[model samples]
Target: MCSRIEDVITEKARTALLQVLGPLPWLEKAQGEVRPTDQIQLIRPYKGGHELALARWGFVSAGMGTAALKKYAMFNARGETLSESRAFGPAFRTQRCVVPLSAFYEWPTVDGKKRKTRMSRPDGLPLLVAGLWNRCEGSEGTVESCTLVTRPPTSDLLSVHDRMPALLLSKDLETWLHGTPEEAQTAALTSWRTGVLQMQAV
Candidate 1:
């Protein structure tokens, strides 16, 4: 699963997001490494339009305080059991979002030794990773957290890791977020072109 990600949104992806959230006044155009608990960009589907939001990388429960964040790892949600999971089910059903990643970091064990690696699109396009986000009232303030949905790795990617982020095409991004839960599940398991995924030692 992806623990670290580089969100260097390319011009094309920036254009796509801008079309949804128009100007993104508060967005700082962050580039490079984004880890758990960090505020990352996400486009939330609202009633009238999309809201560009800054969401924490890990999902924080409403009943839990800030102290519990360090203890629980809710960064990556399993796609196989999304609907049944307490942490990610609700959000997966209604609060889905897209996570644009330039590349994701992974650790693959080869010959019984683990080595850090990075996965990216061979065409240099951004990976529109499927994700779920929610807002919880915290002691400090409202904490909006998001978790990346993960699925069994494609044949080629299994060599690098056992799982990879659920990446959707640019066209299917919004549909996965606003559509029904069944549609979201179908989108999560959609066949992806494995050849475009390039993995290399970081």
Candidate 2:
């Protein structure tokens, strides 16, 4: 249900950070016009480490450039069914990615109403949520989009929602990003044990 995301970090900062991630061979190829259809932005890691990428709002390739749909799209993919769902199975198995966020917004319902809240790690570290992306063709054109992977909420987050985005730590980034298919599946199912998340009303 993470429909709106605030990417406060500027492009320059993102590029600078990416340079530290790893060698980015694609940066030279990233010349096309960025549109709603072009959802994934690739950044070169600073010193030729692992390249980092970000997904934009979970808008999948098929949904981009469509005029008929008006609803806020599904940005978070449930981890339980990620490998089985038709919409995400293939991407989950192969096109896994890491989504970096300062914080993410979730709505808590009360008495049949909803209120917005922001969730972040207690130490204010960027949350590296696991994601799956796909390149699909639509009537308008081809596009790449991604969905945030989600798991059962930790004890600290259960009061707000039953599920929370799959947040990976810096230590686990490599295995999740470049691990083999089997290793990736194992990583996706394992929850980040440290319930260091903090939330506040927004």
Candidate 3:
């Protein structure tokens, strides 16, 4: 599981987003290593195009009480079960978004010692990870949160980790952001099957 990642919305990453997605709205900063529950930059579908928004890292289930929900970690949702999960199913069909990352960290056992590895694309582009978001109202008020989508690692990454974040390619961005549910699913599956990222020991 991808439990930790580099700061998602670095200036460099913002520049990359601008180049691809074009003139994203300026969002407040939440710098440093990002963990679950932190406010992070998310590029979600907006009135036909995309917009930058800040959302908490974990997906909050509206049906579950606060006590029960606290025990469950909803930071990463399994791609295989997207359509079946109560917290993710509805979000997957409509509230999909992209989690941009400068890099993600993985802890892999190498020999007798576990090593920290940094995962990123070979071409130095930002990693646009597919994700789902939801809005839940509670006694405190309303909260918007998101969860990264994960799938079985590709052949090359199996040795490094069992699962990796589902990524979106440049071509599939439009389909994923605005296409029908079926088309979005197809785009997601294609991304999981074909996306490539490189890992390096930090």
Candidate 4:
């Protein structure tokens, strides 16, 4: 499950990124320590165009109180059940999005102890992970949130964890954002090649 991430790009880097990934919405700095419920940068297809928005990174159940949310973790949705989960099904079909991050954190059991691990693109480029988003109304307000879609692990990633976030590489991003849900699901199942995704103990 992708629960924490790093977005260590500088402001200048973010500006350059915006040009390539923009028509972004107004948002504050998101260049480090991203966690569940934090405002995260996401891009979604809308009205024949792409717009970047500051989206919360966890799915909030409708009408759940704030206190309940504090103890809930809906940051990762399993891709195998994308069409089956009540909370994520509709969003997966219609509100698909991509999450941008430099790297994501994981905890893997090694030598009988769990250790912090970091997974990133070997090329140092930012990654766009597949996701589903929703806007739910509650007593507090209308909360817009998202969840990463995870797939069964690639052989390379299996050493770190049994699952990895469904990533949309440059070659597949456009189709994933614009294709039908069935197409997107098929695309997401194509796992990353060995040596493309780097993992290290942190």
- The prediction achieving the highest lDDT against the true structure is 3
RMSD of each: 2.2, 6.0, 2.1, 2.6
lDDT of each: 0.80, 0.61, 0.80, 0.77
lDDT of 3 by residue, 1-202 (tens): 8888765466776787888788887665557578888887788867766788888898887855678668988999988888887768899888999888878888899997899998887766788888888888977888888999888887778888888888778788878778887787777766654346777888
Worst 10 residues of 2 by lDDT: 28-37
Find the number of clashing residue pairs for candidate 1.
Answer: 0
Give one clash count per candidate, in the order shown: 0, 13, 0, 0
Q: Please, what is the TM-score per model?
A: 0.89, 0.70, 0.89, 0.86
Candidate 3 scores a C-alpha RMSD against the true structure in Å of 2.1
Q: What residue runs in model 2 are displaced by over 4 Å at the alpha carbon?
A: 10-20, 23-56, 59-73, 109-113
Q: List the residue pairs that clash in candidate 1.
A: none
Ranking by lDDT: 3, 1, 4, 2
Candidate ranking under TM-score, highest first, comes to 3, 1, 4, 2
Q: Which stretches of candidate 1 lie over 4 Å from their true place?
A: 16-26
Residue 157 CA displacement from its true place in model 1, Å: 0.4
Point out where model 4 deviates above 4 Å: 10-31, 67-72
Q: Candidate 4, TM-score vs. the true structure? A: 0.86
lDDT of 3: 0.80
Better of 1 and 4 by lDDT: 1
